[model samples]
Target: MEETAGDHQACRERPAASHLSWAGDGPETRSGLALGHHRPGETPMSHHLRTLAVVGSACAISATLLSSAASAAPGSPGPARVDAAGDATALKRPAWTRLRAEHSKKCVEIPGWSKRQGVRADQWSCVKQANMQWALWLVQAPGAGGVRHHIYAIQNRNSGLCLTVDAKRNGSSVTQRQCRNKKYGDNYTKQLFWYTPDNRFFSQYAKGKCLDIAGASKRNRALTTVWKCSYAKNQRFKNIK
Candidate 1:
């Protein structure tokens, strides 16, 4: 479902976010209003928490609303939704983002800020730290063979390495490695990935396999691995907040 010009009125009954400088009609006027939504099965981020500590920028929040006013796309519910942390524009730019696994509600982090290859990925309590953020870089090889889905190199803000999967099989370990592609420079299939409408991250190493939380455990420090895509909560992740 997408939102258009009328979405601004969809939440007329709900009060606007606190400290909003203005309550008017356009982004040009810096008056654009935006709303956020939680995916099915996920807890709705509380507005109270957002007001207490906003995580995104004013430009991002406003631009998102105005952008949606002119366009619509799947997974794009309205202008742009700001979760408890901030505006939902994780992949809109080649920016570093925080990915939270749905089932555990934890942010993916490179344990201990290790900068070496083959370090397995882990999910931990969400925190405002560099290790928790990942920078997404699009792999541009339009007609490359073995390519079936849009791919992006998921790089960690702290480790400066791309997320890499060991093999194209279920139970394969997903680790971090230096981004290098002999044919396409940081476009190596094993280091590339794509997300589906179901919110699962599939590595180019195998479209059938998704980034999964080991054992579906909600405990902090649960390791992440590649598993057959099941659309299960453990495999679902969102780059919001």
Candidate 2:
């Protein structure tokens, strides 16, 4: 298909619901230390001074604890902490990968995947080509209401064009189009997709569509399009390498 700027129209907006929940050790508790009582010969002034010192130390410790808690508030995108093993287990981000169709035994490919726009994405015999690999980038969709959904842009490794839904309609053929760099006013919604826990590639723009192998053919060059998502094997794919 010929490349055209008009083929890349604005994407529709959709709300997201996924959020990263923070899991860590519970709030630290400090034990109350018993202050020693004044002895029989101890002066009243000295005992009073000792008591005051203990109270001041306790107050300082309490302030420090509060400060730490505030910094580690839930949903805060702060740096990951090291565990007891001294290993820094940072938040795991999705990586670039090649998607292999479970039933067809093919990989998603963007034919003539270049810097041009309007190239259609399809499936081909599993190969080690770079154009068949995709870089999965997570982006927040519009109208998410503060929830972080698993929206992503499947960008071609060689061409840099993102996997997009042509014409932004249901049953639209999935294709490779220009990547949206801006935050808004682009067809980002059409380009965004999410992988379900069951490994189905769901389209963010299409309300209930998923990336599917047309006709469920198990042959090479079988087309990839958007269709009503189902639990069929043709609709399932997994990232490899």
Candidate 3:
């Protein structure tokens, strides 16, 4: 016999005695607590212990997060970052200033020429000495002849003396000639020369000043003038200091 519609509705609204049990037959309802929701088999005491464990774990995680945040907070000095900046600053310092200071006092010493006057050749040494001025020479050469030969003059402003290179008639001596600017055949060329504190000679005898030599002279007796650099045999000034 089929149950009447009114009877089914009444049964749904008013569940049977078995349905009144705390643990129903279905797995979700069978456990005193919701079955799959958490640990279904745990007793009331076990549930409390599990809750306590979760709370402790959450507290530990929160503490770690807070510590990390504090370490990164504003005004907190990060040691590695500070070290990196210091290293960078050290690297940025100019190296040449120290080099100049270190070698400033050392005078170049050479043979033959007098330290009192005339050009002398010498090597750079690390020592503070008055004679150091002679060790340094100003080099000059003309433009076109930079390849063939160099012209240079050694001058000591403090000593108020200058030296030049001149080829003697016999090549017998590397004469320390008086420094002067002499005119050549044209306005474009002139005499050019330089000297070393160690009595070394560097020079250019080409036909014109560095500027005028561009297209002027063809060969011998061309005028030459002093310039900053010349690759000529004469222009190479040995850096003693």
lDDT of each: 0.68, 0.65, 0.32
Error of 1 at 157 (Å): 0.5
Candidates 2 and 3 compared: the better one by TM-score is 2
- Residue 96, model 2, lDDT: 59
Q: Residue-wise lDDT of candidate 3 within 66-180, one digit each (tens)?
A: 5676676754112111111222312322111100111122233222334343343333433444333432222332354363434333333233233332332222122222333
Error of 1 at 241 (Å): 3.6
Instruction: Give the alpha carbon lDDT tens digit for every residue of 65-111 in model 1.
Output: 86865565544211122111122134354666899999989999999
lDDT of 3: 0.32
User: What's model 3's lDDT at 11?
Assistant: 38
Per-model TM values vs. the true structure: 0.57, 0.56, 0.25
lDDT of 1 at 182: 43
